[model samples]
Target: MTGAIGKPTPYIDAVQKVTGQAMYADDYKFPNMVYVSCLRSTESHAKIKSLELKKAEASPGVVAIVTGKDIPVPFGVLSISRDETAMAIEKVRYQGEIVAAVAAETIEAAEAGVKLINVEYEPLTEFFTPQDSLKTCTPDEQIHAHTKDHKNIHKTAELRFNEPEKELETAKHKQTGNFKFAGVTHGFTEPHSAVAMWNGDETLTIISATQVPHYLQKNLSKVLGLPLHKIQVKKPVLGGGFGGKSDPFPHEMIVSFLSKKIKRPVKCTFSREEVFITHHGRHPTEINMSLSCDDGGKITALDADIIIDGGAYGSFGVVTSYYNGVLLQGPYLIDKFGFRTRRTYTNKHQCGAMRGHG
Candidate 1:
């Protein structure tokens, strides 16, 4: 391959990454800075009847306590779907869904504070898989208010470029195959961490471990009810990100909200298990390929039916649907083609776009 536009460049931060001293979100510290830990729900589905934070606020060394009520704005990565919040409003739709958060003088104090905040729940039936969703369709099937679901299904689609039915009927050789793909976790040793500080005079500064600084900044503004210019979000050196660190997470919102409430800096660091439970991995998918070949070497028809297991929330599930169906538009071409795909919500850790997405 000849030199591409703006010839291939070397790794921009290769040296810094290789060296052990590159500063990340957790490396920086300031005076009176407090650590925050989320009090997440243990159930996969439920209605949050009550959230009591008095004990957390009164805990030893506790500086402040935060819950969904502290931050009212609904924010999300995609501007179109601002359905997420700093904490679950009246319900916990997933197992790791945040119900409240606490900030304290010490890291251990923060963890203790979170445990003090009690979260009450009224259990609801869970949707564990996409197949179960298809079998049961209803207007009230979705777990969330702002989701595109015909029953538990999140998104459904059908696209055709040619008459696959007619071509397949006249084809000579035909074969059908079914396959499923698993998911992946980022395993970025740095842990999902964030730091937020109120820059006095109605402004906020958020130092986040995120790939999309601009998006996170916008989300913080919406979550904190601050103007765009009033808040600044910076992306420090990242240990790693294969899409997991790209989206605006609840911890991100929690820290920002807590900072605004206490008028001080706040930070949240998720444990390894918390990381997997809070966010998402790859889209678990099923593919049905119907391919037919003509008498000669020419291709006749190819049809694909795909379904994606989009866990809990609609976290990048829409785009995953495209990748699941469109990626087949590849290495080979056929005379006729048809593609149909659907993504349904399952009460499991969300299925997001990961490395090599499709």
Candidate 2:
């Protein structure tokens, strides 16, 4: 009944969406566009020992093949952590890390080429989820040796707002709850896909199904080792994103690297199974809440203790841990707030930002 920021208006593309006239990234077609297949690492934790590309390179209609070594740069969605890669060259932390990619004249040929790539794996003891990781964690054992902390904890933090301890002393009412949300996929029927072309003049153009084009442009530039200007990322009308397509995807970069190597257009569209395996989704959070209120029902304090199962890598978990506290501070008036969130790394599929990410 009071002030709302802006009156809701009809979506401009409502017609296109309703009538099935929407042209998503997968809908675009180009002459001589080559299909690409990305080979994902199935080992939850293993070192890539070797690869044999002779058969794949010689396959019929196969233009070229690219692997982690083809693109040396390692990058991530956050500027703070640039540890990820288009393909995992040394060790794969997750089951779906891209190990190799193939580009060919036809989709079938590309898929066949992927099979031809020989990837040798050296097995490592696996940890399934955060609980498992913490239980078996040792000073010598490392899920990510790159982390500043010695343990498998990807990131951890404790933050407080105003003064919570004093306010709770006189509060009349107190309540608390334990909440848990399982990992949920964005489930945008149209799966993640991208078409990348290497322009003859030292530039690459990418048409991807993504939410943050500006971010993708920057991250892709980091991974490709190309200047930001050389890479142009265009996001066509999306069937759905729901925060799934916000980050710079490894598959998208795989296509770009393959396109660069082949000097032709390469397109990689994720299969439904691949979509679940390769892409990052919501993190399962276990939250404990506490609240303090006065006799008149005036709220005095709020506190949240959250543990996020940050599968494998630090996606938005770096910030989600903080957001879980910040985002819940308002909506109900509280004088003081206190929060402590810890995000731990696991061996499952990595958790990135998703709709209702917290």
Candidate 3:
């Protein structure tokens, strides 16, 4: 305990990372490995009218093509809200949602095959802001069918102690403010990548650059219809996560399913743009807050109403919704405190935990 208590410590993998000896997920190569590329949705909110894959199936070096129907099970980090799929099924809620994937001998061939696939979409009314999402819309216009009351509201988190709102109205010294924050991405150096191998024993092994391997494994089993013991998840050297790589991504599921279907190894690596598109970062938030203090500057009460844009899918939004208001209960001695946070589903990229969570 003497040497460990007050000494300056270095990261365990510092030497390996500095010398370029670290093996990231994309660095691994296997015999007969296939590369995968995805075809993404162009419309923010739309139904797939028609998807034509004949040209892509006949493309040079292409091994296989898989759509959402191949693996249609839904999963998410939160147990109560498992609303995300490996790929968009009948309709796409956001732009850049994966619709189909192509596996081929080479990365170039996979990308070329992806370009040959044709898709037609029937556009729907898109909701981009939290306010727009809170309003009631037709069932057909709702971003997610699970949302209740014909609205796009995903989760509503409320907590109260001592009825702070009553104190706010009567306080001698009170302040009220409205704040808005734009959505932010983690901007990690490493782009998302995954490699899946179908083993000889009818088992699956996946190597990925992710922060949550257990969640990835659980979702993989749910989507692939495999037992948890039969699937193995490995986390290689991650460049950086900052909570961006925490979610079980669509590409990971796509590669794993394709590998199992083709009985070979499959890998997918995202470009920077794809990384941005796939990330579940900090939510865009709007907060209306009021604080009351006594004449002696003692904090008496605090209250807030928060609205967070959760985007297309529920990624860790239920927890985030609670944190948006609960995190404000500290650093001051407040007798009365109350908050209500509403998380809404919008036609944009999903938002989840970040460096500081909510």
Clashing pairs in 3: none
**Residue 72 miss distance in model 1 (angstroms):** 3.4
Give me candidate 3's TM-score against the actual structure.
0.98
TM per candidate: 0.91, 0.89, 0.98
Ranking under TM-score, best-scoring first?
3, 1, 2
What is candidate 3's lDDT per residue for 1-358, written digit by digit as tens?
A: 4679788888899999999999999999999999999999999999999999999999999999999988899999998999999999999999999999999999999999999999999999999999999899999999988889999999999999999989988999999999999889999999999999999999999999999999999999898889999999999999999999999999999999999989999999999999999869999999999999989999899999999999999999999999999998767768899999999999999999998888
lDDT of 1 by residue, 206-305 (tens): 8888888998888877777778999888888887888888788888888887777778888887788898786667887889988888678666788899
Per-candidate Cα lDDT values, in order, are 0.79, 0.81, 0.94
Select the stronger candidate by lDDT from 1 and 3.
3
Q: How would the candidate models be sorted by lDDT, starting from the highest?
A: 3, 2, 1
TM-score of candidate 1 against the unseen true structure: 0.91
State residue 82's C-alpha deviation in candidate 2, in Å. Answer: 2.5
Candidate 1: which stretches are off by over 4 Å? 1-19, 137-141, 146-150
